[model samples]
Target chain A: MLQSIIPLAVDALANAALIFFVAVGLTLVFSVLRILNVAHGSFYSIGAYVAASVGLWIVGAGLPDWLTFPALLLSAAFVAALFGPIVEKTLVSWTYGKSEAVQVLVTFGLFLILEDLQRIVFGIQSVYQDTPMTMLGISEIGGIVYLNYQLLLIGLAGVVLVALRLFITRSRTGRLLAAVVADREVSEALGIDTQRMFMIAFTLGVFLAAIGGAMATPTTGVAPGLGADTMVLAFAVAAIGGLGQVEGAAIASIIVATAKVLAIYFAPSLDAVAPYLVMLAVLLVKPYGLFGSGSTRKI
Target chain B: MAHRTSIKTLLAATALVTSASVAVAQDKPASLDVGVFTFMSGPAAAYGMPGRQGAEVVIDMINAAGGIDGVPISATFVDEGQGAEGVISEYRRLAEEPETDFMIAALSSGNCLALAPIADQMEMPTVGWNCDSHQLFADAEHPYFFRPNGNTIAEFMAYVIYFLDNNPDVERVAIINPDYSFGHDAAEIVKASLAAFKPEVEIVAELFPKLGSSTYQTEVSRLSAARPDVIFSNLWGGDLENFVRQAAPRGLFRQSQAVFALGESSMNNVDMPEGVIVGVLGDGWWRSPDAAELGAPEFAEAYQTKFEKAPVFPAMKMANAFMVMKAGYEKAIEANGGAWPTDEQLTAAMEGMTIDTLTGSMTFRADNDGIVDQVVGMVGSVEGIEGPVLTNMVRYDGDAVLPPEGEDPMAWIASLTPDFIAAMPKPGSYE
Candidate 1:
């Protein structure tokens, strides 16, 4: 059991790293914007497409191989920079203070449009740019050969978790965002430039989602329908963690990934439904989530 | 007294039916409008687009040759990436069109199963180009629906025989297939075949990932940790490419005798290490010796010129489907005194017919299932070719592996003995 559990745990953490990037960003957006961005996964895939294209171009142009690492970050920033303001100012802003049904319907429509746009831009064939993944090579853990890149994702997720916490608690803009999350009406009353706050928070969410996609490109193929798959999993993780709870999202990602990895390992038939089953059990026991509160919401 | 129709009324009904049959046998459209259904988008498109291109090029060639009885063939491509409901709707829409004469119904086995009953109901002539699931015709029969590309039973059973022969010392095996009927059915066939041939072997792990899953790291870890002597998967299109890309770097291929059932399609698109076992499901290899003698090399070169990549098995399967369609049309035309053949006549032409293809010949049995050779091999680099191609190929005669007509396929597999495998052709024996 110990031998088996060690590998399962490593697999779970590796899986969780990818899921956490999108789930945390989703919960973060819901925390401040009070809107569930259904199209959030589109940003993730767009970032992936941009990263794959840029990485391929860099390699093709005979640039240094190490540059692919920074290119991943730059690709995420590029996606957020290009799409963040345009989509928020136009489509997502309309859903502000609206009913959840309206928000979902509108964002679902946006999701479809963006999915088509990706096809038009990237075409239907899958794109692969694994310079970053192949560069790091492989490592043995728990008697299993693993990609060092997979371990890097785990470490990056941890760094992002700590850095995000620090940003929210210590940074001025993060404090303003936190204040808004605590009491939106009061923050607006205190002349917080609520409109600017919405843009900044939304853009940051996009950045997180995009980076998640960008980092994933070295391991996975960037293709159509990726956004929809990622979005569904992210939604499950956020719900299992309790919506709008960042740390809750983080823990829930691990739980969900573990459920999936365990299913793949033993109950192979249940791989697809494992995350949902975990969500069902977690929600049944705690209406809020592992780290979420019933009465209070936190950023 | 039983409530029965009057003699006059019965005579009238019989006459009307006779007239309808006669009209179907005699009438032929000036042109054949075929509905070619395959994937044109999404992950499956990696396989589907090649098939679609094959259909296009083959039809263009036929048209350039003045078509059957001077009727140029035209095609309307319906994307099978849409679910079965949409595929059925598209098939029905095309069938309803007076100009549409026949259909190369689908690349997906799921869609093929759904459309089979509808074809029989509508009396439409349909051919399944790449429908590979053994379950398609296990319990169901369709007169107007036929598959020229063969089924999963022959395909996966061949792999089991080939693997057991090459690696007699293998103890444990693992399978990670896509989560679909195609994947699950292959697993069942492989396991059943193994149990009959080598009862001592143990299956250590089995996983069915969701189709089009973008990542396989966890599955890879589980497979590696299982420490199986053999690892087998039937994942195709982008999903297969993705798995090979991720798994190769971790030395999973080096650790186990990795077998990709549909690896031929991605040989050009991705870089696979030498010595991995790959197959094209059917004997549709684009570079086989038989293919070179049969002019398949020229077609492949032409395909590369047009599509920027060499033709894969899916392309060959699609090209073979077109050949079968043309042969059926010509046979029907000849039988009907050089006139156009209706759906019934076309279906009659397809029944119990044997047609030669680019790779090999196929014989359609009474049940509308075709018997074609199954090719399996290890990947190796040729001196002049730019990429890896199949080496150490063994072509198993189709009839030897397929369950006899009307027999329960699984039960027939269970009844086989080790002597049965010993008597069959061994690897590299065909060459």
Candidate 2:
């Protein structure tokens, strides 16, 4: 019995780690920006493409294997720095103070353009770079061998949660960002350069999404349509976690991942719809989500 | 002004007359237009692109060699990765065009099933290029539709018989397939084959994950936990690549002898570990003993020079379909006394015909299903070959594995026994 359940747990954690990155980014952007940012998933795929390309380049150049690890993080940062402020200022800023439908339509258009751009640049073939995964080696868990990189992913997700908490609570820039999130109109009235806050918050969201994509490349094959799949799942996690709640996103990621894992292990037919089923169930019980409140904003 | 006006009017009238004459010429012309469907994107593209490439080369070769009795052949390629609805819409649109003569459609079985009824409705001569589903023609046969390749029963039966013969002591078995009709049908056939040949063997686990899914981490873990002696799967294209990539790292191959039925299609692109059983669905291995002996090496070299990749099964399937088309055109022309034949004559020519392909021969049975040999083998990294190639091969006679004309396939398999397999060719004996 333990043998059976041990693999299930490991699978759930690995699944949860990937979900946490995208969900956290979506939740983070919604918390500060008050916009859903429907194109957030494009950032994730771009990160994956960049990471795969960079990792492949490093290996091709005969660079040391250890550099591949840092290359993953560097690729994500590069995508964020390049696409974050540009998209946030030009396309995303136009959707501000608009209706929800307008925001969705605009960002959705951006998503379509980005998807086409990815195809043009990377072509239609799948890109895989597993240097980091190979370097991590494998471990036996309950008679089943697993990539040690998978375990490291679970640990890294936890560290991100803690580090984000510390940064938001302790740092000066983090406090200003929080101040902007708390009351943007008042903060702007009080001479807080709210434009910089929006730029920083949006860039951070892109970085988070990109990091998720980069980290996942070692285990999964990066292909077309990945952006759309990631976007839908991230939306489900955000909705189940009350949209803009950070801790709620973390907990909701596990719930969604667990539901999908259970469906795969037991009812294989329902694997595709399992996460959405949980989302529907959670929304039915709590209309405002588990952590959401009526008037006050909290993370 | 009067001279210019008269000149413009004459030019317009002349243009209208020429356009009308051109339209009439095309209406009475004898050429055939076919819509060849295959995947051209994603990991499946790795396999599907070869089919498209083969079609291009074959059409060019056929046209140059006097195309179908001097009526030039034309093809419109459609990508099947756009889902079923788009494929059906494209089929309808193409069928509506007056110039379209036939359809060499569909690399996917799901798309084939979706387009079958539409073919009947449109009354288009549609040929399934690589469907391989036994159920497509099981219920009702469309007069206009045909498959000149072996079905799932013939393909999967070959795998089971080969494995059972190779490992007579095998006991436990497991299955992992794409969660669709193709996957489920293959599992059923494997189960039926095992029951007929080795009833004592236990099926420990059966898994079916969604098609085109990017990850197989959980499924791999499940297979590892099951600890079966042999694992059979029909997951092809991107799903197959992803499975191999993930499962190899986890030592899934070390635990059990894996059987990937459509494995040969990915030999060039993926680094499949040695000793895993893989096969081209039919006798489509470009490097097979028959192919090597019959001048397939020069053709393969030409293909590699043209496409920068070796020809996989889909390429061979497409090339064979072109050969079938060529045979039809040649037969029609011969019957018409050396003149371009009409659509009816071409269709008549294709009925009840056999043609020699690059690898082997394909005979269109009475029901329009093709009887072609089933080739199964294992991945062997041979010297001088740039990538892995299928070795230890056994080519099962197409007629031996196929069900009798108008008989139920499942019932046919149920009536078989171990003695039946003993009568068939042994593993690695094809040479």
Candidate 3:
């Protein structure tokens, strides 16, 4: 049992690490903004595209190979800085106090526009940059060769989860954001800058998604239709984890990834629909998700 | 008396004009419109765009050489990436137009299956350019539809033969293919071929990953755990690129004899390791001696001058389809006594037609399925080319591998024997 379980665990954690990055960001934005940002996955793909471009430029320009590591983070920062505020101010802000359908439709429109824009800027062919992946080298686990870059991704995801926990609890802005989540009207009455909180939360969500996509550049190709695939998978994770629950998102990612890995190992036919099967089963038992309840209407 | 004579004279002139036009047709039109379908956007574009470029370059070459028998060819390229419904609708709309003469139908097997019947229904001479699905003609035969390339059964069996001959002591084999008809059909063929030649071969693992899947970390792990002696995959385009990038560093290729059935297309794009087995699905290798002798090298050079990249197999397949169509028209015209033929005449001409292509000759069987040579090779860094090129090549005769008409393809594969393979050309003998 242990022999079979080791490979499964390693594969699940590695897969979950990639999913957790985008899912948590999507959940975070939904929790704070009271709107499911359909365009969150677009930021993730944009980050991947930018990271691949920068990493390729670094290698082409004769820069130190180690710089590719920082290039990933820098690419994410660039995407978040450019797209976060502008989208939040124009599209996201307009959907405030609107019905869920309206908000979803509007962000869905934004998603379509971003998808076309990516095609125009990046062209139809896939973009790949694996300098970081190759530089980090390889390691063997459970008699299977694994990418050390993959191990790094697992560690990075853990670090992000912890850092997000600390930021939401210890920081001053964190307390304000928490208060707004608790009661937006009362937070405003208590002289908290709710608008600023909204912007900060949305930007943070964008940053998380962009970083996820950037980090994935070393393992996957950045191409058209990647954003939509990521978005659908992220939505599954977000739903399974209970919407707006950061820790829930992390745990849900593991469950979903585990399901997918198990399917690939034992049942290859169910590989594509494995995550959704888990979602269906989880949603059946707990209609509001594992960590969700009827009373958590703060969003 | 004058009115009666006038009526009789008019009747006589009308009858004469009708009878005279039947024997001597009008001159060829100023330009011919071709409906070309391929994926122009999205993930599949990685493969489909090459086919599109080949069409563009071939059309340009044809026009430069004074067009197809003096009629300038104009093409309307349709993006087949937009699902089968849209593809069928586009074909119907284009077929409805009297100006559109022929259709280079599609790059996808699914789209080809959908458009095949429609071609016959509309009396359009359509070629299945890049579609290799055997299922396209399994149940129904389209009079107007034809494929100038080899089918999946022969394509997959060639890989199995090569692998078995090289690794006689192989115990376990694995498969990782995309989750679609093309992928599933190839898997069936490979397994059947294995059972036929080497009954003791064990298929340790089989995985069907979703098309356009970005990551294969888990699939890689599963495959590694299986500890197979050989691994075969037919994943192409960006999916293949992603798999190569992820699996190479983990020593998958080094550990196992990796056989990428469609790897030739991405040999230029990916940093593929030498000694990995790859094939072009047909005799589309531009660098193959046969192709070079047949002027494929010149076509490739002209293609590179126009598209800025050397032609891959998809490009070769599309270009060959154009050649086959042009040959059909010329044959039809010849048969019609120096006059342009109708759609029915072209269909008749394509039936049981044999024509020389850039790669080799394609002879259309009575079933409208063409029998072309299958070429398989291993990646080697040739001194002349900038990137890895196919070496240790073997070209299998299509007639020997292809199932006879009206026979079940799987049963035909299962009947193949080791003695059967021994009589064929060995690897590295093509040169």
Candidate 4:
């Protein structure tokens, strides 16, 4: 029984690690900007494509394999730096103070354009670069061989969670963003540049999502429709966690991933719908979400 | 006045007879318009693009050689990545054209099943280039739709027989296939074959991952924990490549006797360790001795020159489809006294016809399902080959493995015995 349970737990955590990155980023964006960025998933896929291309180039050029590690981080940073500010300024900011329906439509249109752009640039075939994964090697856990890279992902997820919590609590920019989240009107009246805060928050959100996608390239294939899949899962996690709670996103990621893994193990037929099933049940009880309050604003 | 009216009636009768005679003898067209459906984009394109490229090579070859009855083949390519509804809409749009001659449609079994009836309704002659589902003809008859590369029963059964021959003592088995009709049908066939051939073998785990899934880590771990002696998968295209990449690192290949039914397609794209069981699903192997003798080498050369890569099984299959189509045209023309044949005449010509393909010979059965040999082998390092090549190969006779006409396929598989397999050809026996 213990033997069986160990693999399930490990697999669940590893799965959760990937989901948490996108989920947390999504929650952060909604918390600050108060807009559901439907295009958030595009940044994730772009990051993955960029990371895969750069990593493949590095290896193909006979560069040192360790460089792929930094390449992953740099790839995410590049996607966030390139897409985040520009998108927020040009398209995302235009929907400010508009209806939610308008924001969603605008962002959904952006998502479609980005998806097409990716196809034009990257082509439709899947891209794979696993040098980083191979470099880390494998380990035997619970009598099942596991990728060391997968374990690294679990640790990285934890590190990001801690770092994100501290940044939101301790850093100056974090405080300003939190202030905007708390009361945007009041913060603007108190001399805080809400526009700049929204940009920072949105950029940070993109960075989180991109890093998640970058880290995932070692263990998965990067393909054309990846953004849609990621976006749906992130939405599920965000909904289950409540729209604006970071810690809730972390918990919700675990719940969703565990549901998926468990379904794969015990009921393979239900694997595709397991996460959504859990979300449906959760929402039936907690209408707002696990962490949401009707009137209170918390980040 | 009565005499004048009689003369006018006689002239009108003569004109009607002349027009009827002209319609009876079909006029040769300026060009033969063909609608070729394949996946030109998405992860499936990893498999579908080669089929498209193969069509181009074959079409170019046929047109260069003066085409079928001297009519140049003008192909309109439809991407199946657009989903079934879009594919059907495209098919209808193409079929509505007065000049459309043929359709080589559908790389997916589901799409094939969807379009088969439509082909009949439209009375259009369409050949399934890569549709491998046996169910395509099991329940219904589609006189207009024909598959020349056989079906999934022969394909998956070949793997089971080959694997059991190599590992007679194996007790446990598992399957991880794409979650679709192709995968489910394969699982049923494999399970039925195993139950008949080796009743004691326990099926430890059966997983059907969604198609185009980027990650298979959780599924891999589940497979690892189950620890089956043999792991059989028919995952193809980018999904198969992804599985191989992720599973290879986690030592799944090293742990189990992995049998990738569609492994040959991804050999050049990914690193599959030596000794892993792989096959081309049918006799679509470009390097087989029979294929080498059947002009596959020249076709492969042309493919390499144009695509910068050797033709994979899908390409070979697509090339074979074109050959079958061209042969049908020739047979129809011969039967029509060297004139252009109508659609019904073409269908009649293709019925029960046998023709040599680029890789092997395919014979259309009474039901329009094809009979083609099944080729199975293992990945091995050769002295001159740049990548892993198939070694220890066996060619299973198509007729021997295919169920008899009008019989339930699964029931026929269930009736098989160990003695049946014992009498079949052994590994490396086809060299």
Candidate 5:
């Protein structure tokens, strides 16, 4: 039992690490921008595609293998830098003061366009670059062999959580973003440039989602529908974590991952619906989620 | 001013066409129009794009060789990732347009089933390039729909017989297949085959994960926990690739013997670990002895040159589908005294026809199911090859696994005795 538990925990943490990045980014965007980026998942897939492309290029060019590690991060940053401001300024900015329905519809349209763009750019084949995974090597934990890259991901998720907390509480830009989230009209009245904050928040959201996708590419193969699948899962995590709660997303990711892992271990039939089942159970118990409440914004 | 000019431009174009038509009498278009359907998006595209690429190569080859009856074949490919309803809508839209003579309809069994009835209604005389499900012809037979690949029953039962021969001492088995009718039906056939061959065997675990699922971490854990002697999966395309990737790192292969029915299709794309059981659903392996013997080396070399990788089973299947199409046309033309046969004549020619493919001979059964050999083998590293390849292979006869005509497959398996296994060929016999 102990041997099995160790591997299960490791698997759960690895699963949660990927889920946390996408979900927290989604929640953060919702909190500050006050509009759900239905296209957030597209950024994830785009990040993966960029990372795989870069890694493949590095390999094809006969460059040093160690460069693959940096390629992952560079790929995520490239996607965030390229897509973030353009999408936010040109398209997402229009949804700033619009209704939720309009925001969703517009972003969904963007998702469709981005999906087609990926097909045109990457073609309709599964792209994989596991050089980073292989480079990190393997370790035995709890009687089961695991990729060290997976363990690094869990640690990275922890660092991101701490770094985000510090940014929101201790940093000037973070304070301005929080002010905008609290009261957009008041922030504008104070001449705080809430529009800029919305752009920054949305861009940061794209960065986080892209990083999640980049990190996941080492373990999971990237394909055409990856963005949509990630989007649906991220939505579930965000909803269960209380739409705009960063900490809620963190806890909810673990909860959802644990549920899925448990279902896979014990009842294989429920593996697919395990996360939603947990969400249903939790939502039934707490209408606003565990950490989510209609009060001052919390993590 | 621009709008008026555009209208005047349209009138000028109409005048130019009228003058050109008068100058040259009636002539057929330079290229034959075909609407090809396969997966071009999503996880299924991992399998479908290869089919599309094969079509591109074969169509080019045909056009280069002066095409069929001297008409160049040009295709408009449709992505099956857009769900069945969209597929039906696209099929209807394409059918309504003139110039689409034949269709290689789908790769998904569900989509093929959906399109089969509609093909009959439209009188399109479509060919199913990769439809493996037996249920497509269960109750209703579509006159215009034809399959030149054997059904799921034949494919899955071949695995069962091969495994039984290879591991005569095996007692426990487990299945982890995609969560759909294809997966479930495969499980049923495998179980039935086992029950018929060795009733003492116990099924310890059966898992069905959703299609397009990226992570199989939990599935690996479950299958590991079960500790069955043998683990079987029909997860194909990206799902199979994902499972193999996840499971390889976790030591699942070291713990239990694994059987991936569609593993051969992914041998070159992924690093499939050594010693796992793998097979092409039909005899579509480009390097199979039959393929090597029957002028398939040229096709294989051309495919590799064009696609940058060796042709997998899906590519072979797609190429074979074109071959079948070409054969049917030739037979129809011959029967019609060297003239273009109507769609009806082509359909008649395809009925119960036997055509030799690159890998093996395929004979379409009266029930619209094609009978083809099933090749099963274990993965091993080849010295000269860049990656792992199948070794210790067994080629199961198609008729050995197929249910008798006009009989329910499940019922037939239930009535079989241990004598059936005793009579079947053993592993490595084909070589």
Candidate 6:
């Protein structure tokens, strides 16, 4: 019984670690910007493509193997630095004061454009770079061999969660961003730079999503249509955890990933629809989500 | 007056003779327009692009050899990545064009099933270059569409037979197929074959991951926990590559005997470990003895020179489909006394036809289904070879594994027994 349960727990946590990044980013953007970023998943896939390409080039150039690890982080940083501000300033800012429907429409259109742009830049074939995974080697857990990179992801996710909490509670910029999320007009009246906070919040969200994609490159194949697949799952996670809640997103990632892993292990046929089923169940019970409140503003 | 009457009679007879000759012969066109369908984008393109390249190379070769009866072949490619509705729309759009003579359509089995009846409805002669679903011709017959490679029944069964022959003590089996008709049908066939040959063998786990999935780590863990003696999968294209890449690091292959039904396609792209069971769905291995003897090397060489890579089984299958199509057209033209044949004439000529392909000889059954050998082998490194090559190969007779016509394939497989398995050839017999 212990043996079986150990494998199940490890699988669920490893699966959750990847989803948490994108989900947290989606929730963060929603909390600050007050608009659902439907194109958030595109950032993740772009980061993955960039990381795979850079990693391949590094290895192809006979660079040191340890550099591939830093390349992953640097690639995510590059994608975030490049796409985050430009997208937030241009098409995203245009829909700032519009209706929710307008914001969603604009972002969905952005998703389509970004998806096509990725195909043009990355081509149609899948890109794989496993140097980081191979260099770390393997470990036997619960009597089954698993890549140490997978375990590292679980730890990294925890680190990100703690770091994000500290940043939000202790940092000056984070407090201002939270102040804006609390009441944009009140924060603006208090001499807070609300527009700058929105930009900072959006860029940080892109970093989170991009880092998630970059970390996944070692274990997954980065290919066309990956943005769509990741986007759907991230939406489910956000919905289940309560949109705009970072802690909720983290917990929801585990719930959603566990549902998916359980379905794969037991029913097998329900693997594709398991995450959606969880979302449906959660929403049916808590209309505002697990952590969301209809009357109170919280981030 | 008698001289005038004689001249009029002579002119009338001349008109009658000219009309009879026109009725018996058709004016040959300047070129043959063929609509080729395969995936050109997305993950499946990893498998589909090779097929498209194969079509290009084969068409170039055919056109260079003074063309088919001196008429060049002009091809327009349709990307199957755009879902079935778009594929159907494109097929209709191309079929309505008067100049379109033939179609070598479809890489996905789902697309093939969707387009088969449409081919008959439009009266277009189409060849299924890589679709191998048994369900395509299970219930209804489509005269217009022909598949010159054996279906999932023979393809999956050949793997089971070969693996069982090598590992006679194998008991527990786990399956990880893609969640589609092709994958599910292959799983069913694999299970049926196992039940027939080894009754005590238990299915420890069965996982059907969705097509185009980027990761298989969870499924890999599930497979590992099952601890089966053998793990079987029919995942192809990038899905196969991803699975092999992820699972190899997790020591899954080291623990279990892995059987990849469409494995040869990724052998060039991925570093598949030695001793893993692999096969070309049919006998499309370019390095196989039969394929080597039939000019597959030359075709592969041209393919490498042009595409900058070796030809996988999908490419070889596409080339073979063109060979069969060429044979069909030539036979129809011969039967028509050197005139271009109509669509019905082409289909009729292909019925029960036997022709040589770049891989091996394929015979079209009465129902326009094909009979080709199944080559199963293990991935092994040969001296001076860059990547993995098939070793310890067995070429199963196509007819020996195929179910008889008008019989339910599953029931036929269930009827098989260990005695029947004993009568079949062993692994490494064809080498």
- Per-candidate TM equals 0.96, 0.93, 0.97, 0.98, 0.92, 0.96
Q: Give residue A130's error in model 5 in angstroms.
A: 1.2
How would you class the docking of model 4? high
How far residue A187's Cα lies from its native spot in candidate 3, in Å, is 1.3
| Tens-digit lDDT string for candidate 3 (B1-431) | 99999989999998898867754574577788999999988778888999999998888888899887888889999998778889999999999998889999899999999989899888899999999899888889899999998899989999999988878899899999999998999999998998999889999999999999999999999889998999999999999999999999999998899999989999888888899999999999999988988879888999989878899999999999999999998898998887987778888998999988999989999899999999999999878678789999999999888898889999888777889888888889987
Regions of candidate 3 where Cα sits further than 4 Å from its true position: A297-299, B1-27
- Candidate achieving the largest DockQ: 3
Interface RMSD against the true structure, candidate 1: 0.7
Clashes of each: 0, 0, 0, 0, 2, 0
Q: Least lDDT summed over 10 consecutive residues: which range in candidate 3 chain A?
A: A290-299
Model with the higher TM-score, candidate 2 or 4: 4
lDDT of 1 by residue, B314-388 (tens): 999999899999999889888877877877778998899998888998999999999999999988987898878
DockQ of each: 0.84, 0.56, 0.90, 0.84, 0.52, 0.80
Off by over 4 Å in 6: B1-24
What residue pairs are clashing in model 1? none
In candidate 4, what are the lDDT values of residues B88-196, reduced to their tens digit?
9999999999989899998999999999999999999999999989999999999999999768988999999999999998999999999988889999999999999
* Top candidate, metric lDDT: 4
Candidate 4, overall lDDT? 0.93
CAPRI band for model 2: medium
Off by over 4 Å in 5: A61-64, B1-32, B381-386
lDDT of each: 0.90, 0.86, 0.91, 0.93, 0.86, 0.92
| Candidate 1 per-residue lDDT over residues A235-285, each given as its tens digit | 999999998887888899999999999899889999999999998898899
Which is the winner by lDDT between candidate 1 and candidate 6? 6
The stretch of ten residues in a row with the least summed lDDT in candidate 3 chain B is B19-28
